[model samples]
Target: MHFNETELPGVGKKITFKNSEGIYTVMILHHNGKREFYYLEDDDDDEPLFSTTLTSEETKELAIKLLGSREDEPDDDSYDHMSLVRKKALVNWVEIKDHSCMIERSVGEAQQMAEEEVSIVAIFREDDLLSKPSDDVMIADGDTLMVLGRKKAVEQFENICKES
Candidate 1:
């Protein structure tokens, strides 16, 4: 990878990296803590094939994602690069109600996942995110579960969780 750093004068700093395959990846960091990312094909045109603007926080999050730091980090790839086959599956969110039957049950014990064919990918409780929770992790009231599966199976899993 060859990286070229240049100052954009009134804007900020711009860093461009050309990989071995000749793909150009550019990131421009503005003085206001905003950032712009660009992807260009290995061609003659200087225009970017894809671009997105990110805030300071979002920029940090994107850095973390690119670095593949931890398991809790969200797995998000630019939709521009996604293949058609990956666009079929759907991810849904289910909130566990306080009076629901799934409360106080461990993920393994509830068996909602096994029976419905839905997989729990992450759990959100208050300000915390529990990513790829183990079977021993207990489901709690008000916890939001990120479930991935076919549409029908996801709906079935939600119905099971929302049932009192």
Candidate 2:
């Protein structure tokens, strides 16, 4: 997995190196938007602490290499149509905020929205982890909704929420 800029601190000081057999002499340094691996023990006195050439890809590769290769790197046959759907604009999306509506009529609105050829995939309560919310879900204050089916349906649903 690519570590985002936030996850890794792109900074370092000094440098040094020794390439010994059976042991890789390297550490990843990320600075600015660039990243790479480096030899921690090997540094010429002439070079500055901030000077080193390491790419994020190389660092990731060396790290993974230390952990051994994964046999499941190329496996993903679980969900049919998932690959294709992934290639297209994702149907799954979240509403920005929980807008109040008649709890009883919410489902009906969702249904009518669905009839317009859009589907109401799901509505999630706020504070949920966003992994997966269940069916028969209810909306409440601070709820985050997960909707799917079609773009048009989602837009219409939002519009109705705005109106109500």
Candidate 3:
């Protein structure tokens, strides 16, 4: 794959490339150590189909996972992208709505309500990220949960959250 880099003058640098699937990808490395990513249908597209911003630390973590560091190796329960597809395993984010049944419940209580094999990996509460949060942590409305499990189990967990 060929990569093209351009300077953004007062901003930083812009890198563009096409992945194996021929989807155009762009990365903007800001001077302040922030990274912005975008995907386009074509190189000349003026607007991105999707975009996201990542801090320096988050970018480094994503790089490590992509490059497969020894410490980041998958365990028995975890699978690579291809393996995950074959096993129907999934990692999903579920947001707690105001009317959801999970609201006001503790993390452990929500887990018990699902009664599935899903694992709540982390909870994103506004600006804070609670990684491997304790079971006693309250599940407030508007909290985003990162869960991992088989497709069916995860779906069941999502259904539990939607129940009132």
Among all candidates shown, the one with the greatest TM-score = 3
lDDT of 3 by residue, 2-115 (tens): 999997643457999999998999998754345789999999887789999886567767877888784854443432332245555466668899999999898888887766
Worst 10 residues of 1 by lDDT: 78-87
lDDT for each candidate structure: 0.70, 0.41, 0.78
Model 1 TM-score (2 dp):
0.45
* Model 1 C-alpha lDDT versus the unseen true structure: 0.70
lDDT of model 2 at position 93: 34
TM-score of each: 0.45, 0.34, 0.51
Model 2 lDDT tens row, 1-164: 22222222113222224444322233333221123444333343323334345343454465467779854432234222332343332243334443445243444454564444444445555444544433344445555454444444554665655544
Return whichever of 2 and 3 wins on lDDT.
3
lDDT ranking from best to worst? 3, 1, 2
Write down the TM-score for model 3. Answer: 0.51
After TM-score superposition, the amount by which residue 157's alpha carbon in candidate 1 deviates from its true location, in angstroms, is 0.6
Per-residue C-alpha lDDT of model 1 across residues 69-104, encoded as one tens digit per residue? 855553344321221223355565577999888888
lDDT of 3 at 116: 66
Model 1 CA lDDT for position 125: 91
